[model samples]
Target: MKLGPIDWAIMATYFVFVLGIGFALRRYMKTTTDFFQSGRSIPAWVAGLAFISANLGAQEVMGMAASGAKYGIMTSHFYWIGAIPAMVFLAVFMMPFYYGSRARSVPEYLKLRFDEKTRGLNAITFALMTVLSSGISMYAMGLLLNLLLGWSFDVSIWLCALIVLLYITMGGLTSAIYNEVLQFFMIVFGFLPLVLLGLHDVGGWAGLKTGLEHVAVSNGFAAGAWSQSWAHMGSPTDNPMGVEWFGMAMGLGFVLSFGYWCTDFLTIQRAMASESMSAARRAPLIAAFPKMMFPFLVILPGMLAIVLHQRLGAGGFSLPTKADGTLNYDMTVPLMLSHYFPQGMLGVGITALIASFMAGMAGNVTAFNTVFTYDIYQAYIRKGAPDAHYLWVGRVATVAGISASVAAAYLATHFNNIMDMLQLVFAFVNAPLFATFLLGMFWKRTTGHAAFIGLISGTVGAAIHHGLTLPLGSVPGIKGGWLGLTHQYTSEMAQNFWTAIWAWSTCFVVTILVSLVTKARAEAELKGLVYSLTERLKSDAEAWWRRPAVLGVIVLALTLVLNIVFL
Candidate 1:
């Protein structure tokens, strides 16, 4: 597909606006705190929007649309069941210890509440994860650009990396945060029209459902299987996702969602940048409102793509297929843009995707730099450094992070399945983290030694489980069963859910058992860091709507309605 002059103009304007913001904020990045933490001066609304945009990356946009095509409305569970509750929990229950304790990063919080070794382990793993995630974002953006416009993948990756690095290195966290707020608007505007136009061509919601009904029947499912979320979740084989209620609810809703939304440093860093404890608490809650409604914006397009080719025939675009002829579901959204958008609107759509790429890549890079500079470098390599020196190191780390991501992007081109393998690594690394944080913050008796040991045990248990089990019709390799195929799963999603459950359970049980035998820290030292040790803060003075708990309740109620309506 070729772009018109109008399209190039819109794309050029976005690049200029982002760079302008970076240069605009250059003066404020003098101190290490300013560079790393946005000087802790961001208002709640700004922080809140940044929090949402930071996570609205390639995975959320492209990956979700892909899943929506494959799994139907059951994919909404990622938002309704998996994300909203955890984000609310973060704002209402967990933000106090994180914000009150003055810990700069999540791993730093582990150090404050647990011990150095626990913090060190978390910092290294998190740092590596960020690099890998950023790299994948690059690959996604590059691949999509290449497919859509025949752009050089190498040039696309480097040019985008250069832009992210320039803005982040110059304006620091403040620039990235503010730019993220802008990107959020671009993404929403870009995709909203696409959803509307796609729905129109499919003859609105009712007609779209009829088309999907045909698809569901063709795929050997019940008529409503592709249109409803919970109706087909009774058994693995009943739904397109091949995941049962127990595994979906416990594994995704409880473990993976909480593990990511609550504990991961990427989202938490945005909340941490808020100016006050109240603002910090409100940030994620503010993010929850949009998050609850995102399925309509992101997921529906994939659903539309499912039957568009059948509707429009020669005029429509179908998803690209892999070597084995399986549809490359990730291409669903980009191809939809090419199919439905006009010349000028097409530019806006492409720019929106680029915004998502930036948000994902920049979020990971900023978080990676902060963690490396404070938790890794300062604590281990160089201690008691002057403020100016660390600030310089932070700028240096930003460049290094971008370079590492670029390298990973090139590595991705050579190995098509590398991302699937990396997901396994992230599963083991991230699945056990919430248990460590949960016990460390809420249970004062939890020992540092136990937190460290439990993390290892959790990751090991996840690997062992994956090794012993294989999803049906898969070979014993990256997909698992290297040890022996003792059990089988109907789908990879089910396998992932079970892996998370086992990881979380192993970590939780091991942490408690070891903490029972090990020594606990003094209660005085735990103040402000442990939940019970600290005084409970309140939003009672604020209006009912502004209160975090109240907002959380409202968000959850709306999500419940959506699930039921779709079901």
Candidate 2:
């Protein structure tokens, strides 16, 4: 179906206006802080919105939709189970340490708490991961646009990257955050309507329940482990594990939620941008509420699509498809939208998807800018440089980051699809880092050397698990030739997840064991590493914890209720 002239006009208008906002904010970014972190003056509400927006990548929409079509309400666990808990933990338990210590970045925190070598290693690893992850996010958007609208994937990616980069480069983090606030609302306004329309098309809740019952899995509630085979290989016919539903949910909740929400620079930068420590602590927790419910906007529609497709006797509704009659599960949501949604709703749905991509890309570029400016250039290249020089570096880096990301998006076309690529990236890069941050923050005895060892081992181990099946290292390059490796692996999300689990577990154990044999940082130096919630800091700590703690408890209670009620 052709996008109507009105639809095109609206999209064009939105794009132009956002670009204008970015340029308008350029004059305000006089210093590195302004360029990278909004000079630390963002209000809590704007920060919260940007926080939520940053997390809403194109893969997230597709993944949520894919799961929704396949898993029913259970798919909401991605956020409800994982993100909310992590967000609450960060706000109530972690933020005080980060904000109080005055660390500019997570790796900086490591250096202050551990050693400079550790910080440098982490900074490099993290930069590489961000590039890969951001590239994937950019790729997903382009892929979606190409598949849905028949646009050239390269052109789509370049256009998207250019817009995001333009704004991010001009206004810096301030522009990104402000635009993110608008993008968040745009995403909700655009997607939720489609979901509502989808339900309407499905004949409401009763029709939804009836459709769900007809599919393979009626209730994802029964307790057994995800099957090791399905979990390992990642079959569309089964849940990632086929493991006990509850255990898989909880385990994933523990791993992914904490990993992405706490450690990911995209989300952390939002909290870091707040005007004060109290605001930083609260902004993330506030964002958590929306995250827990985000599935309603994203994944739920996919589930509804599944129920409708099944009832219509549509085969491969949630499966991948080829030229011949086949299923491409990743296409489920888009196909359903095209088939079911009316013209107006379809327009809105498409806009929401684009909004999701924009918000995520904006967040990614901003975070990339911050890390580039603070960690790399300021820390090493130009130590004690004035803010103006650093700000210039950040803008330059934003362009470079966007260019690299667009190229990555072009390369992603070689991959299977968005969802598979996303999970694959997350497993290797994020899984180990999640373990590292947890150990680093809570365990004072975890040495810098242990962190370095753990991160390298986990990353290399996970890569081996996945890369062994492929020739990722065998590109005609000096590195590839030196390694003497051939691409053997075909990427699969399930394989990646299993690899990630092993990677995380390995890192956790190694870090612990290594710490046992290593010397701890001096207690005085490690003071910022651990939470010191003593009476001396009681007043400050209590004021900080009150609202966020209550919010956290409420979310926990809600998750328990959701488990009982929905899953």
Candidate 3:
């Protein structure tokens, strides 16, 4: 993994351009709105790219490749089933409430639609989750840098923290979103070539498929592991994913996907920063185009890694392995870079990796600062504060959030895989959130107290389901919990899907029953916030193709074709 002076120079050049952008954008931070919401001035295309790039971190690039090597092309399910529909739903059905309600953040929507208690619950949980997620990104950056460049873990962590803090603190969310757009292009340019080169060396898709079937046989897996997606998903024991169609459809596709894509403030903040209602709605739809193609760019490289490893043997191309011979799946992307890329391209690959990491960390930090300063501090601790005072508070919160993230990064070192830990966190925090949002928006009869109770109960159900059903020693990285039942999960991925199901069910049932007993909010107060109460708005001014609903249908149809083709 040695780099030439040319590679070092290229890496240095990328850092200069990124930091320069941050410094250049500092003048834009003239008010709290500018710092937190970009003064609602970003165009649709830029916000759209930033929307997708917010999620295109090390977790996506490195983790998806790892899944490709382990589970084959079925890993595409995480993209197609797990992301696309929810993104489309957000754009077509839900964006009006989010963008039209004048809410500063998602939790603020809860305050307007439900009650302050529900908003408080979401705001606190979200603030904590964002910081912890930011820490995970920091830990990943340090881990990747240490593995690739031989830098110490602490040094890498501090370096990343410092860089994110400087840029985000200076220019706030606007700087972060702008940098995310730049990072998205860097990732596309850096990895598209790697996928093409790897595919060429492996003799194209057909050869790659044959290579995976051979690897599957050698590893005692089904022969179709490389090519099929849903054909082998009839039973939990039939495939490496250990998930059935029902769980995959209802739990992951409907619940988890909607929860993350629609409600998670990390990404919603990008769309909310758009200049107009139409742009806000169009952003996610625009992002869906590139989002659908990422599996080819990121996942194929991991499949290529397997082909290279089997052909070259351990002596020629080694993957990271534990003392017990288990693969450290997170190392897939780095290993591919070391095995296949040359000097200048290698530098670009490394920069892409670092850029993605920083974008992820910055997105979380920005979201956290806004949630803490506006949702928590201004709403409760310092009400009626001047705009300048809140703006200063946001800046101070940025530093504190990054500092907390560094601490969380140190805590994350004990985990085996960053992706597994992230999924676990999502199960605990995000699984039930969409249920709350779903009822709050569509069912005007849903009382505020019911929403609050259902949220707490749903989170509790997710925890209980994981404790009773998830088997001990099933996942490599996480320690098993108590309450072990006779029936155990086949894999962590299965546990994730089922947890969402149970949580969503609990939230839905509890909210409905309790809302029947409790008093509902007045219809006048719910106008524009609830579906039945909100007036229908036309998009005749925009062209047919530019309309969110039209774009959503096109995106969904294309996504369906990809799934069918892959199957």
Give the number of colliding residue pairs in candidate 1. 0
Most lDDT-accurate candidate: 1
lDDT of 1 by residue, 259-309 (tens): 999999998999999999989999998898888889999999999888775
What CA root-mean-square deviation does each model show from the true structure? 1.3, 5.6, 2.2
Global lDDT of each candidate = 0.91, 0.70, 0.87
Q: What are the per-residue Cα lDDT tens digits for candidate 2 across 1-567? A: 568877787787778778999989988988777777788898877888888888777677788777666455656656776577788888877887777776888777777766777788777767766776778787777767887899987787877887887888888888888888888877788777667877787678776666666654444522211111112223332443233343344346676667777877778888888998767878887787787778778876776766665655543334445677644468766776676656666676677678778778777777777787788878888898777777778888998888877766666767645535454554566678778888887777788888888877887777665554432223423211223343332223333344567678878998899889998777777665675421123334455344667767887788667655554
Error of 1 at 410 (Å): 1.4
C-alpha-based local distance difference test score of model 2: 0.70
> Residue 495 of model 3: what lDDT?
77
Task: Kindly list the per-residue Cα lDDT of model 3 for residues 1-567, writing each as its tens digit.
Answer: 888898889888988887888899899899999999999999999999999999998778999999888888888988999999999999888889999997989999999999899999999989988888888888878877887899899998898889889999888899999999989999999888888888888889888989888877777768886668888888877777778888889988998899999999899999999999999999999999999999999998888887777787532565677888987677888888877789989999988998899899999999999999989998899999789999999999999999999988887887646646664755676789898899989999999999999998898888788777754356422533446664577777777788889898999999999999999988999999999999987998889998998999999999999999988
Q: Residue 436's C-alpha lDDT in candidate 2?
A: 81
Show pairs that collide, candidate 1. none
